[model samples]
Target chain A: MTEQLRESLSALMDDEATELELHRVLGELESDAALRQTWVRYQLARSAMGGQPVSHARLDISRSVSAAIAAEAGAETSRSSLRERWVRPLASLAVAASVTAVVVLGGQQLYQAGSLEGQSAPVAASGVSAVGFVNSLGAVPMRASYGAQAVPQLEPAARTAYRELARQRMYQYMQEHAEHAALNSPQGLIPFARVPQIEE
Target chain B: MKCVARQLASSVVCGLLFWAGGVAAQGPVCSEADAEALQWLARTVKSRSEVAYQGVVTLQRGDDMQVVQVARSLADGYSSEHLTRLTGQGAQVVRPHHPLNCTHPGEQLLTLGDRVEAGDCGLARYYRFEVGPGERIAGRQSVKLEIQPRDMYRYGFLLELDQDTALMLRASTLGRGGKILERFQFADLSYDEPLEPRSGMDTVHPAAHPHPDDPTAGARLSVPWIVSWLPNGFTATDAADPEGPRRTYTDGLAVFSVFLEQLPRELRPGEGLARLGSSLSYTRGMHLADQPVLVTVIGEVPVNTARMVADSIRVAR
Candidate 1:
C-alpha cells in the first residue's frame, strides 16, 4: 500500500497523474506522515533544480480539507443529488452541441480545401472530345462554369508535359477498350462508334 | 329519385366490368408482344453476321454527329464488313470476318447455328423487354423495342427495327431518368443496292493516333494485378499489354476496362473523372509492385461504379 502511494505521489510530482491517481495521492498524504515528508523532499529537490528558494516548514492543508469533507458528507451528498438531476441532461446537451460543431467545421475545412486546390492549380482541359461533347449538351452547367472560372495558375512546364503524357495514356486505353468492346459486344460496331476521335 | 340513382349505380358497375375485361385481355397480349419483340431482336443479331446489305448510318452523341456508310458481304460462309465515315475527315474501318468462335461469346450467343441456351444469356432476368409503338425510320416501317435494365449497372436501350427485314434501324442509349445519351440511326438504307468493293480507296485518314501506344498490337497477357471488388455478374473478359497491363470486365451487357501503367518519377499522379457521351472514365494513382502506377477505369457505367472499380484494384500476391 505504501509502495503504491509512493508511485501515485511520484506521478503527481511529475504532473502526469490521472484524476484517480491524484485523488489517491492526496488521500494518502492526509493519512501517512512519512509519505508526506517524502513528497515535501521531492518538491524541494524539484525547486532546487529550477534555482527556486524552498521553505523548510510545510502546511498540511489536505488534512483540514479531508476533515471538512468528512464533516459535510451527508449535507454535500444531499446537495449533489439535487445538482445531478440537471447536470446529467446539460452534459449530454453539451456533448451533442460539440459534435455538431465539429462536423460543421470539418465540412467547412473540406470545402475550403477543394476551392483552394481549384484556385491554386487548374487541371489542364484533358479529353478535348469529352469536354466538347459535354459543353455542346449544356446539361451540366457546373462543368461549363468550372471551365470559365478556372484561371490557370503559373504551373511548371514539366507538369504540363506530365499531363500530356497522362492524356495520351488515357486515349490509348480508351481506344483499346473500344476495340475489345467491338469484339465482345452483341451491339456490333456500336461500341467502336463510342471511341472519341482524338484531335491532334 | 331513388329509382334513378339505382339505374346510375348499375351503369357504373357495367363500365368497371368492361374495363376489367379490357385489362385482362391486355395482359397476355403484352407478354406475347414482348416475346415477339425478343424474337425480332434475335433475328436482327443473327442476320447482322449473315446478311449482305449497304446503308448509311448517323451516329449522334450530344452535339457531335457522324455519318458512316456501312457495307457487308456474305459469301460462302464468310462475311466482310467495311465502314467509311462520310462526314468529317474520311476515316474507314474494315473488319474482315473470320470463322465464328468462342472468342466473342456475345456474338456466339446470337449466332443461329449455336444459339445460347435459354438460361445462358439471362436476358429476361437482367432486362425487361417491351414492344413500343411503331414508327417510320429511313423511309421504312419500323417497330420500337424498349430494353430496360433492371439495375443501375447497365444503361437501358431503345431499338427501332425494320419491321420487314428485322434489322435494327435506330438505337439509343438511355441514361438515368430516361435521358437519351446517344443515338445511332439509319439515314438511308438499301438491301437491293449492289455494294461496290473499294479495295484501293485511300481516302481514309484514320482516327488520330496521338499516342505511341498501339492498343491493337497489345500482347494478350495477364498482369499481376487483382481486383478485390467488382459489381455483380461482372467477369474478367481479357487482359492485354498496351504499353502497360490492361484488364477488361463485362457483365454480359455493360463493360469496363482497367489499365495500369507505370508513371515517371517526376510526375505525380492525380485522380480525375472524364465522361464521354454515356460512358465515364475514372483514374487514380496507385502503388503496385513497389512502383507508382496510373490506374484508369473506363466503361459505359455509372461514375460511382467506375470509381469503385478503380479504387478496388490491388497487386495480386
Candidate 2:
C-alpha cells in the first residue's frame, strides 16, 4: 500500500480513526491501484524482514470466512415463505426449547427420587418390616463408610444438577400427595412437618 | 448431472435415518397375552400386601437372633410383633389403614399427599432397578427382580416376586459390593386367609400412650458418640424424644436404635457389641462436657454397620 494508505489503515486498526475517516480510507484502498500495490509491498517487506515465507494461508482464511457468511445470508433470505421463512425456524426453536425443558424436567424427577431414597424408604423399614425385622448385627463388615463415600464419587456437577431438580419434583409430588390425602382422610388434616424450604 | 445424483443419494440416506429414529423411539406395544400375565402378577402382589398371612421370619446378622411374627391382610395393611431378647421389649407398629403414621414427622411420612395423586418417579432416590431373570418362589413361578443402589448412599434389594400377584415372596438387602446384608423370608406364608380377630390384633395397636410422656420412650434417645456419616438411603426414620432419652435411625431396610442414657461421669470409650441370632448391637460411651452419653445401635447388618450408624448419631440442637 502507499505510505499514506498504510498509515491510515494502521490508524483504523488502532481505533484512532473516526468512522468517516475509516470509511474513506477503506473506500479509497478498495479501488486505489497504487494503494493496493503499496499494501502488498508493505506485507512483503515485513515478512522478508522477519525471514518468513510469503503466506497465502491468511489470504485463504479471509476469503473462506467471507464466503461462508455470504452463503448463510443467502440461505436466510430464501427461507421466506410463510411456512419456510417464519414458521419452520420458529418451530425449530420451540422444539429445541421443549426438548431442553423435557430433559431438565425429567432430570428433576430423577434427582428428587434419588435424593429421597434416604427418606421415602422410612416406611419400608418401619412399616413394611412387619413381615420380618432383621436385627443381625455382625455378619457384615466395614462397608458402611465405603457406601457413604460413594456419594462424592458422582460427577459432582451432574449429581448436583440432577439432585436439585429431583428435590424440587419430590417436594411438588409430596405436596400434591399430602394435599390429596388430607382431602380424603376423615381426620380433617394430615399432620406432618412442612416440607422444609430449600436454602438458596 | 452430478448435483442431481448427489441429491438423490443424500435423500435416500436421510430417509433411512428418519426410519431408524422412529423405530427406536417406539416402545414395544403390550399384546393381550402379555397384559394378562401382568394383571395376574399385579393381583398376586396386591394379595401379599393386603391378604392376611402369618409367618415366623428368622433374621440372622452375621450370627445373631432377631425373629418376629408378621401378619397382614388387605383389610389391614400390616401388623408385626418384633421379637426381642427381653421377654416383652420388642416394639410393634400397626398400620390398619396406612402403613405409615402420618401423625408423626417421620422421614417423608409428612408427604402423605392424596393417595390419588401420582407421585413423581421417586425410585432413583434410593434404588437402582435392574431387570432380572424369572425364578420360582413359594412353589409358584416368580420374577427375579433387583433394586440396586445407583450410589453407595443406600443398600440394594433383591426381590423374588410371585408371578401371579407381583407380591414379593422373598427380599434381601445387599451391600455396596452386592453382598447380601440381610434377608426376609417366609418360614410359612400364605394368602387370602382371614386372620383371627384376637390373635394378633392388639399387637398392632399404636403405642397407646404418646411416646413422649413415657420415661421408657426416651430410654435410648441419646448417645455420646455421634454417627459421623449416614449413607444416602438412610435417615432418622424415627425419633422418640431426642430430649426424652432414646432415638432411632433406619434406612427403610435396617434399624439403628440409639440409647442415650446416663453413664458414669468418667466413662471411657470402648466398643460394646452384642449379637443375638440374626440381630447385631453396638454400645459406646461419650461425653459432652460433664454429661456422659451412651449410644447403642442394633440392627441386622454387621457390627461395623451398626457402629458406623451409631457413630453418625448426633444430638441435633
Candidate 3:
C-alpha cells in the first residue's frame, strides 16, 4: 500500500477522513488485500485502546482453519479424500481463531452491463472492432460504447460472420490461456470459467 | 475459565498480533500451518487436476454473467472435463485429458536462482502471499488465499481453495483501480463419488482447442519477433513450441500472448483495445511490406501495458 493511502486509512479511523479520502481508501482496500487487513488492524487497535469490548475475542482464524487445512492435507495425501463428503459446521466453531472476512458476495450481481460509461470517450467508430467487449452477456449486444473496434470494411453479412469468427477466436484464446495459466500457476481451474458461446 | 480470561485479555494482544501480521509479507498468521498460504497454494495447484467434482460455476465480468455446469475428473493423470453452459446459447465444450505441454512455473524458477527448490517459483518476489479468513462457498468450507501482485504490470487474484479438496472454488481478478474485473465462483459444488465424467455428453460439437505444445502442428519453428520491452519478470515460455504466429509469456503468475498474423489484403483496421472481463485483446494493424500484418496482444494485463507490448513487437529478419 502507498503511504498516501495509509494516511487516508488512518484519517478514516479518526473520523476525520474526507469523502474523497474515504473512497480512495475503500478503493485501495478493494484491490489490495493487504490494505483490507490493515484496515481491520487499525480498527482493532483503535477499539482495543478505547476499551470497546472486542466483538471478536480472537483476532485470527489461524488455529482452527489452519488445523482444518493441515488435517485435510493429510487426508488428501492419503488418497482417501472426496470418497466421503465431509461438511463440517464451521460457522458454529468459534473454537480457536476469529477472522473477519468481508466477502460482499451476498448473491448480488457483480457488474452491470453497459456500465462502461466512464471509460475513454467514444471516438469515431473504428473499422477494426472489439466484436463484443461490453457487458454483453446475451441481451446486451455490443453497443457503441468504447467499441472493441469492429472491422468496418466488411459487408453487413460478412461483418456478422467476422464477428462470430472473432468471438470464437477470442474465446479460444481466453480458454487456452486459462488452461496454460491453471497448469502454470497455483490458481487451478479458477482460470477457466467455461467457454463463452460461439454460435449466435 | 482461563480461556475465557485469555479471550478478554486478547484485546490488548490483538494490537501486537495485528502489527506482526499486517506489516509482514504474509497474512495475519493465525495458525502455524497457515503461516504462509504458499504451501497451501502449492497444494491447491496440485489438487486441481486430481479432484473430481461437478458444480455450477457463475462467472461475472463487468455485468456480463455466465453460468456453466462443470464436471472434472482425473483421467490419465490430467484433467478431462466437460463443461455445459447454463447461460447464453448453452454452448458446450468438452476437453478430454491430454498431455499438457506447458512448463510449470517451478520449472522456470531455476533460471532465477540455483538454490530455489523444485515446485517453488519464488512467487514471493512478485506477490505478497497471505491466507485470508475461512468462508463457505459452493456449500463447502473454503480457505481464502490472497495473491497480491507487488507490481502494476499484472492483476491480483483472490482465490478460495476448498478446505477438503484444495480445488479453487472462487477466483476474483482485481483491476481497473481496485474494482473487480471478473469474479468466478461456484454457485453449487459437489464431490460425491462416481461423478458423471464425460459419459453421455455430446462431445462431438467443438473438437479440442489446439494446444500450444501440440507436436502435430504443421508449423515447425517460430520466427523470433523481438519484444523490445516487457514487464520485469515475464519470460518467453512458449519459445520452445512449434513456430507459429504466436508467442506466450508468463511472470510465474500472469500470462499473455502475442499473435502477429500477416493478412493477404491491404485493407487494415486501426488499433483497438477490447476487454472481456479483466482479460484484454489489443489489436494493432501495420503494413509489413506491401501486406498488412495485424499484431494483437491478448491476456489479463493492463490495457496500457498490453498496448505497449503490442507496440514493442518487431519481426526479426
**Strongest candidate by DockQ:** 3
- Tens-digit per-residue lDDT, B78-140, candidate 3: 566666666666455555653332324422331222212332234555666678676899788
Q: Any runs in candidate 1 off by more than 4 Å, and if so which?
A: A1-170, A198-200, B1-38, B100-103, B108-121, B197-223, B239-244, B266-270
lDDT of 3 at B75: 60
Which of 1 and 3 is ahead in TM-score?
1
| Candidate 3 accuracy as TM-score | 0.54
Q: Pick the candidate with the highest lDDT.
A: 1
- In order, the first chain's TM-score in every candidate is 0.29, 0.22, 0.26
> lDDT tens string, model 1, A47-127?
211221112223543554344435444443455766867675554344334322332232223322333223222233333
Instruction: For candidate 2, write residues B172-229 as lDDT tens digits.
Output: 6676466665565545556645344343332333312122112233234333344555
lDDT tens digits by residue: candidate 1, B156-207: 8888888877787898889867898888898888886437645544453232
Residue pairs with backbone atoms closer than 3 Å in model 1 (clashes): none
For model 2, the superposed segments whose C-alpha errors exceed 4 Å read A1-200, B1-49, B55-70, B74-123, B150-154, B195-229, B275-278, B300-309, B312-316
DockQ of 2: 0.01
What would the TM-scores of all predictions be? 0.56, 0.40, 0.54
- Put the candidates in lDDT order, highest first: 1, 3, 2
Indicate which candidate wins on TM-score. 1
